[model samples]
Target: MNGDLNERSTGRQRVLVIDDEPAIRETLDTFLSWEGYEVATAESGEAAVKQAKEEQFDLAITDLRMPGMAGDETVAALKRLHPNLPVIVVTGYASDEAAMRCSKEGAIRIVRKPVQLEDLLSLVKAALG
Candidate 1:
Protein backbone atom coordinates (compact mmCIF):
# COMPACT_ATOMS: atom_id res chain seq x y z
CA MET A 1 0.00 0.00 0.00
CA ASN A 2 1.02 3.60 -0.54
CA GLY A 3 1.00 4.22 3.18
CA ASP A 4 4.09 2.08 3.61
CA LEU A 5 5.74 3.72 0.67
CA ASN A 6 4.94 7.15 2.10
CA GLU A 7 6.34 6.32 5.52
CA ARG A 8 9.93 6.20 4.30
CA SER A 9 11.00 9.20 6.38
CA THR A 10 9.77 7.57 9.59
CA GLY A 11 12.96 5.42 9.74
CA ARG A 12 11.32 2.22 8.47
CA GLN A 13 13.40 1.46 5.42
CA ARG A 14 11.27 0.75 2.35
CA VAL A 15 11.41 -2.48 0.33
CA LEU A 16 9.70 -3.27 -2.97
CA VAL A 17 8.39 -6.77 -3.73
CA ILE A 18 7.74 -7.49 -7.41
CA ASP A 19 6.13 -10.71 -8.64
CA ASP A 20 3.16 -11.68 -10.81
CA GLU A 21 1.74 -14.24 -8.41
CA PRO A 22 -0.65 -12.78 -5.87
CA ALA A 23 0.40 -15.34 -3.26
CA ILE A 24 4.10 -14.55 -3.61
CA ARG A 25 3.42 -10.84 -3.42
CA GLU A 26 1.29 -11.22 -0.33
CA THR A 27 3.71 -13.56 1.40
CA LEU A 28 6.71 -11.31 0.95
CA ASP A 29 4.72 -8.20 1.78
CA THR A 30 3.43 -9.65 5.01
CA PHE A 31 6.76 -11.11 6.03
CA LEU A 32 8.72 -7.97 5.30
CA SER A 33 6.11 -5.81 6.99
CA TRP A 34 6.23 -8.06 10.03
CA GLU A 35 9.99 -7.69 10.04
CA GLY A 36 9.54 -3.94 10.55
CA TYR A 37 10.34 -2.79 7.05
CA GLU A 38 7.92 -0.76 4.97
CA VAL A 39 6.90 -3.06 2.12
CA ALA A 40 5.29 -2.39 -1.25
CA THR A 41 4.11 -4.90 -3.85
CA ALA A 42 3.86 -4.75 -7.66
CA GLU A 43 2.25 -7.26 -9.99
CA SER A 44 4.58 -6.52 -12.81
CA GLY A 45 7.80 -4.82 -13.71
CA GLU A 46 5.86 -1.95 -15.24
CA ALA A 47 4.06 -1.25 -12.02
CA ALA A 48 7.32 -1.51 -10.10
CA VAL A 49 8.88 1.03 -12.40
CA LYS A 50 6.00 3.44 -11.82
CA GLN A 51 6.39 3.12 -8.08
CA ALA A 52 10.17 3.50 -8.30
CA LYS A 53 9.70 6.86 -10.01
CA GLU A 54 7.14 8.03 -7.47
CA GLU A 55 8.65 6.66 -4.27
CA GLN A 56 11.93 5.58 -2.73
CA PHE A 57 12.90 2.04 -1.73
CA ASP A 58 16.10 0.92 -0.08
CA LEU A 59 15.91 -2.41 -1.94
CA ALA A 60 13.79 -4.45 -4.31
CA ILE A 61 13.16 -8.22 -4.44
CA THR A 62 11.77 -9.23 -7.81
CA ASP A 63 10.78 -12.48 -9.49
CA LEU A 64 13.04 -13.32 -12.41
CA ARG A 65 10.28 -14.19 -14.82
CA MET A 66 6.91 -12.54 -15.31
CA PRO A 67 4.22 -11.75 -17.87
CA GLY A 68 5.89 -8.60 -19.17
CA MET A 69 9.13 -6.72 -18.69
CA ALA A 70 11.07 -9.64 -17.25
CA GLY A 71 13.17 -9.30 -14.12
CA ASP A 72 16.42 -8.52 -15.91
CA GLU A 73 14.80 -5.71 -17.82
CA THR A 74 13.11 -4.58 -14.67
CA VAL A 75 16.45 -4.39 -12.90
CA ALA A 76 17.94 -2.25 -15.63
CA ALA A 77 14.92 0.05 -15.69
CA LEU A 78 14.94 0.42 -11.94
CA LYS A 79 18.65 1.24 -11.93
CA ARG A 80 17.96 3.99 -14.45
CA LEU A 81 15.38 5.43 -12.08
CA HIS A 82 17.59 5.01 -8.99
CA PRO A 83 21.09 4.14 -10.00
CA ASN A 84 22.05 2.94 -6.55
CA LEU A 85 18.85 1.14 -5.67
CA PRO A 86 19.85 -2.35 -4.53
CA VAL A 87 17.96 -5.23 -6.18
CA ILE A 88 17.74 -8.94 -5.37
CA VAL A 89 16.56 -11.17 -8.23
CA VAL A 90 14.32 -14.06 -7.17
CA THR A 91 14.00 -16.80 -9.74
CA GLY A 92 12.73 -20.34 -9.98
CA TYR A 93 15.18 -21.08 -12.73
CA ALA A 94 18.53 -19.82 -11.54
CA SER A 95 20.61 -20.94 -14.45
CA ASP A 96 24.10 -19.63 -14.93
CA GLU A 97 23.01 -17.43 -17.80
CA ALA A 98 20.15 -15.93 -15.85
CA ALA A 99 22.33 -15.33 -12.82
CA MET A 100 24.97 -13.66 -14.94
CA ARG A 101 22.38 -11.59 -16.70
CA CYS A 102 20.90 -10.41 -13.43
CA SER A 103 24.34 -9.58 -12.08
CA LYS A 104 25.16 -7.69 -15.25
CA GLU A 105 21.95 -5.74 -14.98
CA GLY A 106 22.94 -4.42 -11.55
CA ALA A 107 21.15 -6.83 -9.24
CA ILE A 108 22.85 -7.05 -5.84
CA ARG A 109 21.98 -10.73 -5.51
CA ILE A 110 19.93 -13.58 -6.99
CA VAL A 111 17.74 -15.61 -4.68
CA ARG A 112 15.98 -18.72 -5.93
CA LYS A 113 12.23 -19.00 -5.48
CA PRO A 114 10.52 -20.72 -2.56
CA VAL A 115 12.59 -18.19 -0.73
CA GLN A 116 13.78 -18.98 2.77
CA LEU A 117 12.56 -16.18 5.00
CA GLU A 118 15.51 -16.15 7.37
CA ASP A 119 18.09 -16.10 4.60
CA LEU A 120 16.22 -13.36 2.83
CA LEU A 121 16.06 -11.37 6.01
CA SER A 122 19.80 -11.70 6.35
CA LEU A 123 20.31 -10.40 2.84
CA VAL A 124 17.88 -7.58 3.46
CA LYS A 125 19.63 -6.49 6.61
CA ALA A 126 23.04 -6.70 4.99
CA ALA A 127 21.82 -4.63 2.08
CA LEU A 128 19.88 -1.97 3.96
CA GLY A 129 22.15 -1.55 6.97
Candidate 2:
Protein backbone atom coordinates (compact mmCIF):
# COMPACT_ATOMS: atom_id res chain seq x y z
CA MET A 1 0.00 0.00 0.00
CA ASN A 2 1.17 3.59 0.75
CA GLY A 3 3.78 2.45 3.26
CA ASP A 4 4.20 5.06 6.00
CA LEU A 5 0.98 6.26 7.56
CA ASN A 6 -0.96 3.94 5.28
CA GLU A 7 -3.65 3.58 7.86
CA ARG A 8 -4.36 7.19 8.80
CA SER A 9 -5.69 8.10 12.22
CA THR A 10 -8.67 10.14 11.07
CA GLY A 11 -10.04 7.30 8.95
CA ARG A 12 -10.62 10.02 6.37
CA GLN A 13 -9.36 9.70 2.83
CA ARG A 14 -6.12 11.66 2.50
CA VAL A 15 -5.97 13.81 -0.61
CA LEU A 16 -2.91 15.38 -2.18
CA VAL A 17 -3.62 18.68 -3.94
CA ILE A 18 -0.84 19.98 -6.22
CA ASP A 19 -0.83 23.38 -7.83
CA ASP A 20 1.49 26.32 -8.48
CA GLU A 21 -1.06 28.86 -7.28
CA PRO A 22 -1.25 29.40 -3.55
CA ALA A 23 -4.82 30.60 -3.76
CA ILE A 24 -6.04 27.50 -5.54
CA ARG A 25 -4.15 25.24 -3.23
CA GLU A 26 -5.50 26.96 -0.14
CA THR A 27 -8.99 27.07 -1.52
CA LEU A 28 -9.05 23.35 -2.29
CA ASP A 29 -7.45 22.64 1.04
CA THR A 30 -10.06 24.62 2.90
CA PHE A 31 -12.95 23.28 0.89
CA LEU A 32 -11.84 19.67 1.10
CA SER A 33 -11.03 20.11 4.76
CA TRP A 34 -14.50 21.40 5.43
CA GLU A 35 -15.89 18.43 3.56
CA GLY A 36 -14.11 16.13 6.07
CA TYR A 37 -11.17 14.96 4.00
CA GLU A 38 -7.54 15.23 5.02
CA VAL A 39 -5.77 17.38 2.46
CA ALA A 40 -2.11 18.09 1.65
CA THR A 41 -0.88 20.80 -0.70
CA ALA A 42 2.20 20.86 -2.91
CA GLU A 43 3.39 23.69 -5.14
CA SER A 44 5.17 21.53 -7.68
CA GLY A 45 5.13 18.01 -9.05
CA GLU A 46 8.45 17.20 -7.40
CA ALA A 47 7.17 18.29 -4.03
CA ALA A 48 3.99 16.32 -4.49
CA VAL A 49 5.91 13.13 -5.24
CA LYS A 50 8.22 13.71 -2.31
CA GLN A 51 5.27 14.06 0.02
CA ALA A 52 3.73 10.99 -1.52
CA LYS A 53 6.89 9.08 -0.65
CA GLU A 54 6.30 9.81 3.01
CA GLU A 55 2.55 9.58 3.08
CA GLN A 56 -0.26 7.69 1.40
CA PHE A 57 -3.10 9.49 -0.31
CA ASP A 58 -6.41 8.30 -1.70
CA LEU A 59 -6.53 10.91 -4.44
CA ALA A 60 -4.33 13.56 -6.06
CA ILE A 61 -5.44 16.77 -7.81
CA THR A 62 -2.72 18.40 -9.92
CA ASP A 63 -2.33 21.40 -12.20
CA LEU A 64 -1.30 20.77 -15.81
CA ARG A 65 1.51 23.27 -16.18
CA MET A 66 3.82 23.84 -13.28
CA PRO A 67 7.30 25.35 -13.04
CA GLY A 68 9.01 22.05 -12.55
CA MET A 69 7.41 18.77 -13.63
CA ALA A 70 4.39 18.89 -15.91
CA GLY A 71 1.09 17.41 -14.83
CA ASP A 72 1.34 14.41 -17.16
CA GLU A 73 4.79 13.58 -15.87
CA THR A 74 3.53 14.01 -12.33
CA VAL A 75 0.72 11.61 -13.06
CA ALA A 76 3.15 9.09 -14.49
CA ALA A 77 5.46 9.39 -11.52
CA LEU A 78 2.65 9.23 -9.01
CA LYS A 79 1.24 6.20 -10.74
CA ARG A 80 4.63 4.55 -10.62
CA LEU A 81 4.79 5.12 -6.89
CA HIS A 82 1.24 4.03 -6.35
CA PRO A 83 -0.30 2.26 -9.27
CA ASN A 84 -3.80 2.31 -7.84
CA LEU A 85 -3.71 5.99 -6.94
CA PRO A 86 -6.46 8.00 -8.64
CA VAL A 87 -5.40 11.36 -10.07
CA ILE A 88 -7.43 14.37 -11.23
CA VAL A 89 -5.79 16.92 -13.51
CA VAL A 90 -7.01 20.52 -13.17
CA THR A 91 -5.84 23.11 -15.62
CA GLY A 92 -6.72 26.55 -16.95
CA TYR A 93 -5.78 25.41 -20.44
CA ALA A 94 -6.94 22.01 -21.59
CA SER A 95 -5.96 21.24 -25.13
CA ASP A 96 -6.64 17.93 -26.88
CA GLU A 97 -3.03 16.90 -26.43
CA ALA A 98 -3.21 17.71 -22.74
CA ALA A 99 -6.28 15.57 -22.28
CA MET A 100 -4.77 12.64 -24.16
CA ARG A 101 -1.50 12.84 -22.30
CA CYS A 102 -3.28 12.99 -18.97
CA SER A 103 -5.31 9.90 -19.77
CA LYS A 104 -2.31 8.01 -21.09
CA GLU A 105 -0.32 8.87 -18.00
CA GLY A 106 -3.01 7.50 -15.69
CA ALA A 107 -5.17 10.44 -14.63
CA ILE A 108 -8.73 9.33 -14.02
CA ARG A 109 -10.27 12.70 -14.88
CA ILE A 110 -9.32 16.19 -16.00
CA VAL A 111 -11.04 19.20 -14.48
CA ARG A 112 -10.52 22.59 -16.05
CA LYS A 113 -9.51 25.58 -13.96
CA PRO A 114 -11.72 27.95 -12.02
CA VAL A 115 -12.63 24.67 -10.39
CA GLN A 116 -16.16 24.34 -9.08
CA LEU A 117 -16.19 22.88 -5.59
CA GLU A 118 -19.33 20.90 -6.27
CA ASP A 119 -18.03 19.32 -9.44
CA LEU A 120 -14.65 18.69 -7.89
CA LEU A 121 -16.30 17.13 -4.86
CA SER A 122 -18.30 14.83 -7.07
CA LEU A 123 -15.20 13.77 -8.97
CA VAL A 124 -13.29 13.30 -5.77
CA LYS A 125 -16.04 11.15 -4.36
CA ALA A 126 -16.15 9.02 -7.47
CA ALA A 127 -12.37 8.73 -7.53
CA LEU A 128 -12.04 7.74 -3.89
CA GLY A 129 -14.81 5.21 -4.32
Candidate 3:
Protein backbone atom coordinates (compact mmCIF):
# COMPACT_ATOMS: atom_id res chain seq x y z
CA MET A 1 0.00 0.00 0.00
CA ASN A 2 1.20 3.44 -0.88
CA GLY A 3 0.39 6.91 0.52
CA ASP A 4 -2.10 7.50 -2.26
CA LEU A 5 -5.46 6.85 -0.57
CA ASN A 6 -7.68 8.58 -3.09
CA GLU A 7 -8.44 5.31 -4.86
CA ARG A 8 -10.08 3.71 -1.82
CA SER A 9 -13.82 3.07 -1.78
CA THR A 10 -15.99 5.00 0.64
CA GLY A 11 -18.44 3.94 3.39
CA ARG A 12 -15.86 1.79 5.10
CA GLN A 13 -14.74 2.33 8.70
CA ARG A 14 -12.76 5.51 9.23
CA VAL A 15 -9.58 5.26 11.31
CA LEU A 16 -7.32 8.06 12.52
CA VAL A 17 -3.61 7.26 12.54
CA ILE A 18 -1.49 9.50 14.79
CA ASP A 19 2.27 9.26 15.00
CA ASP A 20 5.10 11.77 14.96
CA GLU A 21 7.26 9.48 12.85
CA PRO A 22 6.63 9.84 9.17
CA ALA A 23 7.37 6.18 8.53
CA ILE A 24 4.87 4.95 11.07
CA ARG A 25 2.14 7.30 9.90
CA GLU A 26 2.59 6.35 6.27
CA THR A 27 2.84 2.68 7.06
CA LEU A 28 -0.38 2.64 9.03
CA ASP A 29 -2.20 4.81 6.53
CA THR A 30 -1.26 2.47 3.74
CA PHE A 31 -1.96 -0.71 5.66
CA LEU A 32 -5.36 0.42 6.90
CA SER A 33 -6.30 1.78 3.55
CA TRP A 34 -5.42 -1.54 1.94
CA GLU A 35 -7.55 -3.31 4.52
CA GLY A 36 -10.54 -1.35 3.22
CA TYR A 37 -10.64 1.34 5.90
CA GLU A 38 -10.81 5.06 5.32
CA VAL A 39 -7.57 6.39 6.84
CA ALA A 40 -6.56 9.82 8.08
CA THR A 41 -3.06 10.60 9.27
CA ALA A 42 -1.83 13.23 11.76
CA GLU A 43 1.79 13.99 12.57
CA SER A 44 1.25 15.44 16.04
CA GLY A 45 -1.10 15.15 18.97
CA GLU A 46 -2.30 18.72 18.51
CA ALA A 47 -3.03 18.09 14.86
CA ALA A 48 -4.74 14.83 15.77
CA VAL A 49 -7.00 16.66 18.22
CA LYS A 50 -8.05 19.12 15.56
CA GLN A 51 -8.62 16.38 13.00
CA ALA A 52 -10.67 14.37 15.42
CA LYS A 53 -12.88 17.35 16.06
CA GLU A 54 -13.41 18.07 12.39
CA GLU A 55 -14.04 14.49 11.31
CA GLN A 56 -15.96 11.48 12.55
CA PHE A 57 -13.56 8.62 13.09
CA ASP A 58 -14.59 5.14 14.19
CA LEU A 59 -11.22 4.37 15.78
CA ALA A 60 -7.88 6.03 16.57
CA ILE A 61 -4.38 4.52 16.67
CA THR A 62 -1.81 6.76 18.39
CA ASP A 63 1.85 6.66 19.31
CA LEU A 64 2.77 7.06 22.96
CA ARG A 65 5.87 9.25 22.73
CA MET A 66 5.34 12.31 20.56
CA PRO A 67 7.00 15.73 20.42
CA GLY A 68 4.58 18.01 22.22
CA MET A 69 1.37 16.39 23.44
CA ALA A 70 2.17 12.62 23.56
CA GLY A 71 -0.33 9.80 23.22
CA ASP A 72 -1.77 10.00 26.72
CA GLU A 73 -2.46 13.70 26.40
CA THR A 74 -3.99 13.13 22.97
CA VAL A 75 -6.15 10.33 24.32
CA ALA A 76 -7.30 12.52 27.19
CA ALA A 77 -8.21 15.33 24.87
CA LEU A 78 -10.00 12.93 22.55
CA LYS A 79 -11.97 11.50 25.45
CA ARG A 80 -13.19 14.94 26.32
CA LEU A 81 -14.34 15.45 22.77
CA HIS A 82 -15.85 11.99 22.29
CA PRO A 83 -16.08 9.77 25.33
CA ASN A 84 -16.99 6.58 23.52
CA LEU A 85 -14.29 6.74 20.85
CA PRO A 86 -12.08 3.64 20.76
CA VAL A 87 -8.32 4.13 20.80
CA ILE A 88 -5.34 1.82 20.42
CA VAL A 89 -1.93 2.96 21.66
CA VAL A 90 1.18 1.89 19.75
CA THR A 91 4.49 2.74 21.37
CA GLY A 92 8.13 1.73 21.38
CA TYR A 93 8.54 2.88 24.99
CA ALA A 94 6.03 0.76 26.83
CA SER A 95 5.62 0.80 30.61
CA ASP A 96 3.29 -0.62 33.20
CA GLU A 97 2.37 2.83 34.40
CA ALA A 98 1.39 4.01 30.94
CA ALA A 99 -0.60 0.87 30.20
CA MET A 100 -2.50 1.13 33.47
CA ARG A 101 -3.20 4.78 32.91
CA CYS A 102 -4.39 4.20 29.36
CA SER A 103 -6.68 1.44 30.53
CA LYS A 104 -8.04 3.63 33.28
CA GLU A 105 -8.68 6.45 30.84
CA GLY A 106 -10.34 4.10 28.27
CA ALA A 107 -8.00 2.82 25.57
CA ILE A 108 -9.19 -0.42 23.99
CA ARG A 109 -5.65 -1.75 23.76
CA ILE A 110 -1.96 -0.81 24.13
CA VAL A 111 0.33 -2.50 21.62
CA ARG A 112 4.09 -2.30 21.64
CA LYS A 113 6.11 -1.26 18.61
CA PRO A 114 7.21 -3.79 15.95
CA VAL A 115 3.69 -5.10 15.98
CA GLN A 116 2.54 -7.60 13.35
CA LEU A 117 -0.18 -6.42 11.02
CA GLU A 118 -2.15 -9.66 11.43
CA ASP A 119 -2.39 -9.28 15.20
CA LEU A 120 -3.25 -5.63 14.87
CA LEU A 121 -5.95 -6.47 12.36
CA SER A 122 -7.51 -8.86 14.84
CA LEU A 123 -7.45 -6.24 17.57
CA VAL A 124 -8.90 -3.65 15.25
CA LYS A 125 -11.73 -5.94 14.29
CA ALA A 126 -12.49 -6.73 17.91
CA ALA A 127 -12.33 -3.11 18.94
CA LEU A 128 -14.59 -2.03 16.14
CA GLY A 129 -17.07 -4.74 17.00
Best by lDDT: 2
Rank order (by TM-score, best first): 2, 1, 3
Candidate 2 segments whose C-alpha is farther than 4 A from its true place: 1-7
Q: Write candidate 2's Cα lDDT for 1-129 as tens digits.
A: 345546487889999999999999999999999999999999999999999888889999999999989999999999999999999999999999998999999999998878889999999999988
The lDDT per prediction is: 0.92, 0.94, 0.87
| Candidate topping TM-score | 2
Task: Write model 3 residue lDDT over 62-129, tens digit each, in one string.
Answer: 99999999788888888888899999999889899988777777888999989998899888899889
lDDT of 3 at 108: 81
Candidates 1 and 3 compared: the better one by lDDT is 1
Q: Residue 5 in model 2: shift from native, Å?
A: 3.7
Clashing pairs in 3: none
The deviation in Å at residue 70 for candidate 2 is 0.6
